[model samples]
Target: MRRLGLLRLALGLAFVAGVSAARADGLIVSLSSREVVIASNYQGGSITVFGAALDKDGEVRPPGPYDLVVTVRGPLETIDVREKTRVLGMWINRRGRDFVRAPTFLAVLTNRPVAEIADPATLKREDLGLEAAAERRIAGAGERPTPEDAAFVAALRRLQEGRRLWREDARGVDFIGASLFQGEIALPPNVPFGTFDVEVRLMQQGETLARQTTSFQVVKSNFEARVAGLAEDRRLAYGLVAVGLALLLGWLASVIFRRD
Candidate 1:
C-alpha cells in the first residue's frame, strides 16, 4: 500500500514538471540597434535581429529545427486608393477607398517557406504572411470588402513592393547553431520616420512555441528635424522661408546666366 502511494505521488510530480516545461518553452529576441537615424543624405540601412530558445528552466538550450520569422512594421498611415475609369479616351480617377491606419512599411524575413511552417488559417489569424497582412482591414471600412476591394488591395501591395517599402525574403533568417538564430531587415531609403515594431516568432511543428516583440525609432537628423518641426509647428513661417529660398535661387540663376 505504501509503495502504491509513493508511485502516485511521483507520477503527479512528473506531470507537473512536464506542464511547467511546456509553459517555459519560449524565445528571447533582441536587435542590434534600438534606434536608426535618417540624415539628410541617408539612403538606406539594415538591422540585425537575433534570438535564442529558452528551456523550462529559462536557460538556453541546444538549437533544434526551429523556424524563425522576423517582421518589421513601420508606423500606420491613412492610405487612399483611387480607381480610374476611361472617360473621353482619357483615364480619370472616379472612385476611391480609404484605408485608415495601414502600415506604411512592412518587411518580413523567414527561415523557411511560411506555408510549410503554418496552415492558412493560422497564418491568417496571426498575420504571418504577406497575403495575410494585406487582408487585414481596419475598422470603418463601411462594409465587408468585395472582389473589387481585393483587387484594389492587391494594387496597393504592388505599389508598395515597387517602392521597396514592403518585402518578403524566404532565406532571410539563418540559424547559427542549435539554439541561436539571426536575420536581417533592409530599411529602404524612403522608410518613413516613426516608431517601428519588430516581431520574432519561433515555431515548431506548425505551432508557435514562443514570440517576442521589440521596437525601434527611425528619426530625422538635426537639420531635417528642425525643418519638420517648423513645418508642423509654424507652417506660415516655413512657407515664408521656402519662398525666400526659392527667390534667392532664382536671383542666383539669373546672375549666373546673365546675357553679356
Candidate 2:
C-alpha cells in the first residue's frame, strides 16, 4: 500500500507537470482543506472544491464554454452483495456477487445532468459517471461482467446509495462567475476513514480539455485513534480488558440493586 501510494504521487506530479508544459489554458482546483477529522459528534459535512477554467489567453471563460465534472472516490475494496430467499420459514443466502476493485465511496457531481455533458461513448471513454464507477472486475479474475451481472450491479448500487456511500448529484456544482465554479461533495457521518481522490475534469463538447487530481484524508480524532490503535495492536489484551470491565459493571449493578 505504501509503495502504491508513492507511485500514485509520482504519477500525479508527472501528469501535472506534463500538462503545465503542454497546455496554456486548463483547470485549476483547490479544496477547502486537505484533511477531515471525524469527531465524536460528526453528523455529516461537505467537502468544498473551488476551481476555474482558463482560456487560451489565461482568461476565465463563461459557463457554456466548458463543462466540469467532479468525481470523488474513496479507497477501493471488494464487497459482496447477497440475495436472500425465504425457505421453510427461514431466510437463507441464495447467491451473491463479489464486486472487485469497487470504490468504498463514490460521488460524481456535475453542473447539469450528465447526459447533457457528453455522449454515451464519450462518457464511457472518459469514465464519467455512476456506470463508470462500477465498471470493474466482477467475481474473481474475470474483468468482463456478464449480461446477468447487471442485476447484481444494480443491487450493489442500491445498497451503497442506501448507506449514503455512493451518490450522483447533478446540481452539486455551481458556477460562481464566468469561469469560476464550486462543487460540494457530501460526506456522510459514517464515511469511511481513508484517503479520497478528487478528480476535476474539464470537458468541451465531448472532448476532455484538462484534468486536475488531488486528495484528502479522513481520519479519526485523537482519542478515537488511540483506542482504535490499542484494539488493533493488542487484540488479546483489549478483549480481556473489555470483558473484565463489562463483568465489573454487571457486578456493581447487581450489588446496588439487590433487595433485602
Candidate 3:
C-alpha cells in the first residue's frame, strides 16, 4: 500500500507539471488602447493589437506552423433588414427578416485565409471566418436554413460590408519576429458606441492551442457624454439649453458675417 501511494503521488505531480507546461506555451495579447473615444470631428480610427507566443520557460516560442485569428465583436442589438419592391409608382416593402442580438460591428482578422488554416468543422466550431460569423446566430434554430434564408444572410453581409461595419481580411495579422505578431482593428466614423469583445486564437494543425478574450469600449467624448446624460436626466433644461445655444450661435454668425 505504501509503494502504491508513492507511485500515485508521483503521477499526480507529473500530470500537474504537464498541464502547467502546456499553459506556459500559450499566447498573450495586449491592445494599444482600451477605449475608442468619439468626438464631434471623429472620422475614424484603428486600434493595434500586439501578441506573443511563449514557451514553457516564458520565452518566445520558435516559429512553426502556427496560426492566429483575431475576431472583434461589437455590441449586440436587434436589427431588421427589409427588402423593397417597385410598386405602381413607388418602392414598397416586400418583406424583412429580424436578426436578434446581431453584432453592430464585426471584424475577423487572420494571418491567412481561414480555409487554408483549418478544416471546415474546426472553423465553424470556433466561428473563425466570415461565413461562420454570419450563420452562427441563426444556426441554433434547430432547422437547416433554406435557399431563401441564405439569400437574406448574404444580403445582410452585403449591407453591413457596404457600411464598413463588417470586415474580414485574410492578411491582416502579421508576425514581426518568430513568435511576435500584430494586427489592427479599424473603427469607421459611424461605428456604434458600446463595448467590443476581442477574441485571439492560436491554432496549430487545425487544433486550437490557445485562446484569449478581452474587451474594449467605444464611447462619445466627455462633453458629448455629459450633454447626453443631461438630456436624459433633465429633458426640459437640456431642450432650453440646446435652443439657447442654437440661437446664440445663429446671432453671432449673422453679426460677424453681416454683409461685411
Candidate 4:
C-alpha cells in the first residue's frame, strides 16, 4: 500500500511538472480604492470615485469596503462605481455632508456623472442595454428621450430590482460598499496550470456600457504536494481511510476514559 501511494505521488508530481511549463495571464485592475463611502446626499449628478489607476503591480489593501475608481484610456465612455443604500440613493447631503441625501427630483441623469474619459468609443448599444432611442439619447442625448427611450427607462427599472450591478452616478451610491464588488479569484489546487480569463464590466441601467477584460495565470513556483495527489490513487484513498479509523479510535478512547 505504501509503495502504491508513493507511486501515485510520483506520477502526480510528474504531471504537475509537465504542466508547470504552461503559463497563464494575471489581469489586475487597480481601481481608485477597494473601499468607499457614499454620503446619503450624492444625488444624480456627475459623481466622482477615487482610486489608483491600473498597473502591473496593482495596489492591495486589507479586505474591507472600498470604492473602485474608474479609469479608462481610450475613446470609450467611462463609467464610475458608487454605493447606494436602500433609503438614500447616491446623493450626498449637500448641507451636512455627513449624512446621505436624497434629491427631490424623481429622476435625474441615470447615467454619466463627473467624468474623465480618454476618448469616446463606438458605444455598443447592446452594452448599454437600452432601446434604440434611449441608447441614442444617452450616447448622444439631443434632448428628452424619444419614444425609443422607453426601452432605456425599462432597463433602469430592471436594474434596480436587486441592485447587483454597480454604477457611477449618485442614484444608488449611498448604500454601496466594497463588499458588494468582486475581489481576487482563488485558483484551485489542481487548476491545470495555465492562464484564465477574468472579466470586468460597467453596467448602467441594466446594460453593459463598458468592459475591461483581462486574465490571471497560476505558476508552479510555489506548490504543495499533498493537495496535488488526493484526486488520483487508491493509495491516498487508503490514507484517508486510515485517518478516519485513527480519529474514530481517538474518540472512542476519550469517551471510555471520561466515563471512568
Candidate 5:
C-alpha cells in the first residue's frame, strides 16, 4: 500500500509540473495595489499595472512589436436612458430605454489606436474598444430596439463620458524595451465601491497572444462604514443624530458671527 501511495504522489507531481510548463510561455501581470480604501475626503488615486512576456523557457522574449490594452471595469448596475423633447415650449421626457447589468465605471487604456492594432470584428469579439463596451444590453421592454433607439444609446454614452464615469485613453500604456510594459489607471473620487476587474491583453500582428486579469476592491473607510450601517439599521436614531449635529453647527456659527 505504501508503494502504491508513493507512485500516486509522483504522478500528481508530474501533472502539476506539466501544467506549469504550459503556462510559462504566456504573459504575467501584476498590480501595485490590490485594495483601496475610500475615505470621506478621497479625491482620486492611480494604480500601476506592469507585466512582461515570457518565452517557452520562462525567459523574457526578444524585442518585437507588441500591443497592450488595459481595461478597468467596476461593478454592474442597471441604468435608464431617457430622451427629452420640447413640447408646447416645455421639455418633457419622451422615449426611454433601460439597460441592465451595465458597468458603473469603465476605463480603457491602450498603447495606440485600437483600430491600428485589430480589425473591427476582432475588437468587437474581444470587447476591446469603447464602442464595444457601450454595446451591452439586457432584455428590454420590447423584442428589439428600433432605429430611433440608436440615438438614445449615443446620448447615454455622451452623458457617461461627460460625467467622467467612462474614459478611454489611446496613448496610456507604454512598453519599455520590448519585454516590460506598464500602464496607469486613475480612479475618480466617485468611483463605485465594489470589486473592480483589471484586464491586460498582449497582442501581436492584430492577434491576441496572451491575456491576464487581476481584481481589486474599493471599500469605504471604517467611519463611513459605521455611519452607513447606522443609517440602515437605526434610521430614527441616525436621523436624530443628524438633526442634532446640524443644529449644533448652526448655533456655533451664529455665536461666532453675532454682532454685540
Candidate 6:
C-alpha cells in the first residue's frame, strides 16, 4: 500500500508539472512591421496560445497588407482547468454579445486608402453544433474536453464559419485568423496604405470570451515616397497648376471683353 501510494504521488506530480510547463505563458502576436496590429490587453483571464507544439520552423509566411491572429490552448493551471468547466460551453455565447450591435470587424489599411476586411459570422452556441456534440456524450458532459477534441472543434469552426466583408475599410488588406480558440494569421503586401485594424475575439456557442483590437500603419515604400515627392512629376501638382492657369486665362478674357 505504501509503494502504491508513492507511485500515485509521483504520477500526479509529473502530470501537474506537464500542465504548468504547457500553460506557463500566453501567446503574444505581432506582424512584420508595416501591416497588422493587435489592439487589446490579452492578459486578463483568457485563453492564450503559447503551450502547443507547432511546426514553428515550417509555419507559413505572412503576406504584406495582412492580418495575423494567434490562438492558444492548454497549459492550464488548476484554476484555469477548473474554470474551463464553466467557460467551455458558455464562452462563445457571452463573447458574442459584445459584437451584437455591429458585426465584428478586422481590417487592413493601405496607402491607397482601400481596406480589406473580414467580419465574423454571428452564431449562437447552438449554431456552433456544440449542442449536438454535448448531447452525444452525456457521459462526457462531466468530463472536460480533451485537448484534441477541443482543438478539433476550433479547427472546424475556422474552416466553415467566418465573416465576409461587405464594405472594406480604408486600410489595405486583411485575412481572418483561423480560430479564436487557437491560431495565428499574417498579412501581406497586397495591402495599400492606411491603418489596418486587428481584432481577435473568443466566442463559444455564439457568445464571446473576450475581444481585442489594435492597428498597424502602412506607409509609402521608399520608392513610393520619392515618386510622390517629385514636384515636376506629381499629378496633383500639375493639376493644381492647370487649375491656376485656367483661372488666370478666364480673368484675362473677362478683362478684355469689358474693355471692348
TM-score for all models, in order of appearance = 0.82, 0.83, 0.79, 0.21, 0.79, 0.27
lDDT of 5 by residue, 5-117 (tens): 33443443354244332232367776666788989899989776666777767678886888888888889888788778898999999877876777888888998997888
lDDT (Cα, tens digit) per residue for candidate 4, span 1-260: 64653444344334423533221221123222222222233222221221111223433323332222222111122221133334465654231111111110111112233222111232333222122212342444344555544444445434422242222332322212221222222222223333333334444334333345433333333222243444345577868877998999999999989865
lDDT of 3 by residue, 1-260 (tens): 64653344344335434433223247777666789999889999988766777776777889998989999999998777788889898999886777678888999999999899898777767777766666666533434666766777788889999999999989988776578777789999999988999988888888888887778899989998898889899999999998999999999999999996
Give the Å shift of residue 215 in candidate 2: 1.1
lDDT of 6 by residue, 1-260 (tens): 64653444344335434533222112223232323222232211211121111123533333233232222111111111111224555633221101111111222222222111222233222221222222222223224555644544343333212422112223222232321122222223233345544444423233433344434464455655555555557878767877999999999999989865
Off by over 4 Å in 4: 1-196, 201-210, 217-240, 247-260
By lDDT, who's the top model here?
3
Higher-ranked by lDDT: 2 or 3:
3
Considering only N, C-alpha and C atoms within 3 Å, which residue pairs clash in candidate 3?
Answer: none
Clashes of 1: 2
> lDDT of all the models against the reference?
0.77, 0.78, 0.79, 0.31, 0.76, 0.32
TM-score of 2: 0.83
How many clashing residue pairs appear in each of the predictions shown? Answer: 2, 0, 0, 52, 0, 46
lDDT of residue 79 for candidate 1: 74
**Whole-structure CA lDDT of model 5:** 0.76
Off by over 4 Å in 5: 1-25, 138-147, 243-260
TM-score for model 4?
0.21
